[model samples]
Target: MLKYKILWFLFNLKASLASYRHEVHELGFQKGKKHLKVERIGYLPQQVNESSGLVYLAQDSTLLTHNDSGGAPYIYQIDLSGKLLNTYPISQAKNVDWEDISADEQGNLYIGDIGNNSHQRRDLCIYQVNKKIDAVLQKIPIHYPEKQTVPDAEAMFVAQGSIYVFTKNLDKSGTDLFVRKIGDNADTLQFKSHINLRTPITGAAINPQKNKFVLISYGKIYYFRIIEHQIDFSNPLYCLNFPHKQTESIAFLDENVVIITNEQGEIYRVCEN
Candidate 1:
């Protein structure tokens, strides 16, 4: 049984017409259209960008943990069945600014609290959380920029034990990214290297097997072919029409398929065929 709110959202999102490209026009996409090979499994939804939502890929389980980016300071963790698991509060959780979470192989989680719209922040933070989810208040510590502040990043990806932050607001000065290596759980992650996109970046994705990486920006998703010694980011193997909506989250189900969910609860599966 679906909640009234979830059902209403699905009904409204699916009302939008099915088109490879959508105009500025507005339509609630109807669910019956695209042969949704994926299921509505669960939702970690935020009201617009007021909070963050997370869902595990293994099962349709959703963790209703949203950062209190406005009213409270708790990260409410819910099971995929939408059951409230636990609430971890952080005095550092900012209002309407906390973006997303990324996890490494060690079960450690990174909370990105750098969604600055004014682009004035000198230090961007990627908060670190121990693999033990129930770890307690103050169990996690946040790291911010020591010199330059990079803002408007809604995307984070884990690679080689480091957290990579991508900026949605690519400015003329050329957008740069951050690399932070995790240590002792709470110790300041060592800043490794900055990868200059030379252009603004929008989204990021790593394959399920942790073998490949893809970035979405300038209205396209480009794949990165990785070798032992070099990573080729020259071009995407194949590209699909960027969704009608400005997509935010990218989660891979396997090597050949991915489920890109829009903020409005619309999920699109990019099949590699």
Candidate 2:
């Protein structure tokens, strides 16, 4: 426990320094009005103490989330009010280090077992499950480019039949974006681009419209405009700062409203002010 505490402290220190550098150097372009209204909605069930991934299922009007690393191989279904509605167990999957969850337009859900904190994991993969969440459809193995050290990642989303992954970038001020088609076979993740956000991205979500996306960090929310279905990293719509702790997952309630969850099982809602 003490080791973890020390590691956490160091991580925060590095993140703070990176943010400071970005502000001091004016590294990127952020436009429009600032500030967001954040409200603590409720707390998740005790059983889901380490909620790491979140996705809104509009079909059932419920939210789905899973544990961080080794808790269980089950997904918990809850409502906007934080009430536990049901639990769906992925009978043939292992939790390993489930970091994020995303869904394609067909209602097919994907689980990212891609957490590589030690930067030495080689069996990283994403699990594709049916919308019913009862069975594993496919295990899509993921790998970094040859000779590239693995980095920890917690943010991922699926859009237009493609999966987008953003690395945590704990040691630097930038995150790399990797892309791969939904049904692609086991192969290396293609390095698409990089963004110097000066903070580790913990969660990601594409709004209902598919023209905009948001990435969440410990104390910041980054809104980006997706032009021509391509993520525009050069300009950010909003970089709203807020007070949050260990925020690990995010999902769009709508195009403007977002729901956030932390490791402590607390839920919060953020909307444009």
Candidate 3:
């Protein structure tokens, strides 16, 4: 009987140790520690001199991008190799400072025309269009509450049925974040929070499945986790610096894969191993 009791004790001890080890592995993930690297994958077409924003279409394995204010009012379709496949023209909308493009899961694309460089534009809006066509469905007008001076922003993304804009504050203050419901009829957009990223943010993207969002500046990328519908800026989960001349756009190919583009038409792929 004593021999059987001893064997049972040994088995229970081994099980406990295994469970402890499993928990340690999970903790590492929660801390956002991982091996990752960024490499130049391709170059954009020479025509896309200022590739401002990028959105990946997983349904067809293609990318939709556009230039900034001075370019034509058209969307360029490209592949992973930066090869221009097609162009869709939005005749109804003017390309007045189109800084970012975001696509929802429901085949709708949102074009942000909210660039206020001089801080004097009272006509800030986002154009919603069909993903497969060149038709502008509707225009969502935005207003900064209690202030006539609107902030200049170049990065916007759609997630969880809401649109968010991150500012590129030149005043050296922290960046301001704004949120608006998808279909709400509010004249003034709701202010959510602020992120103290001192550098000017040029682009943003989200990895939905992993609950992670990335922000890009001139030569640096910042990662943050989304918690309770707000950006958790306690500290950046990860930060990376790469050789980018003028990085302006970012997109997620998957939870671990990221694609970035620069104003000079260079494309890079960042992967986590």
Candidate 4:
């Protein structure tokens, strides 16, 4: 049996890298949510934490804690509208080089802790919230994926009952996206494939239907349709970007729209026309 893989469909054209601008334009020839300005729940100045990676607008609210000067992109809980409800504290804050956060429909939240510099680290793993969440219980539990042999990647996507990882592919001409199913050393995930993104992808997310995907990077947002074969890295179907600090997470609120979150906890709602 052929191991089925997910691919994104591209629909638009042209590529120009220069200056940062914020404008909404529906690329013709093809098709495509909330109107409220993401009311600032509250913010920590950029100087607070020098580094930024992933932010899981985690489904659990009580698990969310407030800021601790110890480490990381401070974890927090916010309403769908982006209001700060609570924040989670980091106890040890060890190896939390978080790249992005992905959640299964079952409410299982996967935090991508693999952030590699120079692609040198050999040991990598994903932090699985092993603690079972009960409708009656209000505390957070900690769980982790066994271990992985895949290279460190800043991008992660939850799809087809597994997880997909992609690195920045920075300074190497076009981008390259790597795929791997989620598992551990005990029950390792099979290696899927490596894709040449040809685009600078900061982060990515799979839709609820798991039919399509969206990515944000290099100050632009791109969309893809799922295909049976490997992706063709030559062109993107549709792409757009705003003047933000390179987006990190792309969560789909619906088929025609999605949410792109920046490092500083800012979010953009893209509505296709």
Candidate 5:
């Protein structure tokens, strides 16, 4: 009798999930209805001109950022107000199109050097470092198994013991999401899914609970909820608008609040209304 009841419960749960996914697919991706007012909270020091990636370090109430390729292979530590605190140099890593940053539960950081603008580079990798700026840098190489043209990715986040990368939709066929185990051998990455965002993706951040994943473009932010270990991207709960044109980086200030940074070194915070 107990086994029968468990089977019935699982069946109902699967049915409900299918129903929800279908409903969202029908609704499609719509423009965010929430008009969030972006408040400029601080100005990044001139040293970080192109703040390509951002991650909020909750332990210290600070932010970690790094510039794009052609810049130093260093990460910048800043306060919530965008004031420069210190710079940690990664002597072993090259800035070859360093596009995004992510951190794990152990407070270790990962820098994605997976940006291939020209779509021809053969080498793609990520740099792992400690949060305290004292550990030795480690390099992990990754190859996209099914990609013919080199993939250009600017957004990445570590979740569920794996690191996921969101590729830029330069091909206009929507973005492809890739995932790989954090400690796995430096092997080819597996394709997770194709996110039909209908727009270019620049940055992304996952909330502390791993329940909400937010992706940002130039003018909008799309929110996705995690369901059964998969992202339900059908109908986003919120589509928040960003006032700036060059919003290249995003980090969650909290469960309901987010902070964005532009290429010109301006910081803005938007909260759910």
Candidate 6:
């Protein structure tokens, strides 16, 4: 057990160092006008060190998050002050690289088990959990059409009865948007569009009104305006410099306020300046 813990520590350290280097390199490109005001709020509980997904529950006024791959299959609920409120366990599902979580209007939460860093996973799927019952409603299997080498993705959002997944694009070329409608069985993801951001996308969140959404990378945040109920990737509403380290999750506190969290358990709140 001690050996495993040591390996985990070393792995985290290596990842942190890489992220720091990327952040440093991005400093030169972020010299323009900063559009968002970011403030450190608090540190999350030690148990949530690798928080990977974030979503705000307006009805309960709480935030729900979960860890990344290799962590237990549990969702941690927390308050705005970064205090752990509760832990909900999903016994029906396995934590095969769970990357992001999204919620629909019908009180159902979608846990994306879609992280494919090796680009060789064939068992990718999404778990739909009914919040009220605290149980998984269905397991939606996902497949990439006409592609054997699947791209990794860590960001997802559910909008207008469909799930939108944005690829991380391990090559740092850009991100591709894929969509799969909510259904009773498995389906193939349809490639929708692409954004030329030249960075890996870590997390994404749509506002309560569903008119806008934001994608977060290690050192940048890209905001898009939803036009005619669709994501408009052509012209971003705002491309702000985030300058954070290993940020993996983001959610909207409201239409204007966004909450971001990294693997180091630091919490940051971003708002338009």
State the TM-score for model 6: 0.87
Estimate, for each residue in 95-117, the C-alpha lDDT of model 1 and write its tens digit. Answer: 44566665666656666666665
TM-score of each candidate? 0.61, 0.91, 0.84, 0.63, 0.86, 0.87
Candidate 2 structure, TM-score to reference: 0.91
Error of 2 at 251 (Å): 0.4
Runs off by more than 4 Å, candidate 6: 1-33, 184-186
Query: What local lDDT score does residue 271 receive in model 1, on the 0 to 100 scale?
Result: 60
Ordered by lDDT, highest first, the candidates read 2, 6, 3, 5, 1, 4
The candidate, 1 or 6, that scores higher on TM-score is 6
Predicted candidate 2 versus true structure: per-residue lDDT over 1-273, tens digit per residue: 449635764565445434433533464435323546788998898878888999999887889999988879999999987899999999889999999999988889999999988889999989999988899999999888875788889899999888889998876558888888877774788888888776778899999999889988876678887888786465467766644677889999888889999887799998876
Specify the highest-TM-score model's number: 2
Name the regions of candidate 4 deviating beyond 4 angstroms. 1-74, 89-93, 130-152, 183-199, 228-236
Residue-wise lDDT of candidate 3 within 112-194, one digit each (tens)?
99888788888999999996757999999978787757888889999888888898875547678888888898868778877
1-273, model 4: which lDDT tens digit per residue? 012101111111122243222122222212211222222333333332322333333444222222211255345555545555654543433444566666666666566666664455544555555324212111112122334433446667666556676666544344445455454333333444444444456577766666667666645565666666343232345545344553455666656656665545555567665
Number of clashing pairs per prediction, in order: 13, 0, 0, 14, 0, 0
Instruction: Return whichever of 4 and 6 wins on TM-score.
Output: 6
Model 1: lowest-lDDT 10 consecutive positions: 23-32
Candidate 5's displacement at residue 206, Å, is: 0.3
Q: How does residue 208 of candidate 1 score in lDDT?
A: 60
Better of 4 and 5 by lDDT: 5
The most accurate candidate by lDDT is 2
Give the alpha-carbon lDDT of every model.
0.49, 0.83, 0.77, 0.47, 0.77, 0.82
The order by descending TM-score is 2, 6, 5, 3, 4, 1
Candidate 5 lDDT tens digits, 216-273? 8765577877767785354366554454656779999788788899887899887766
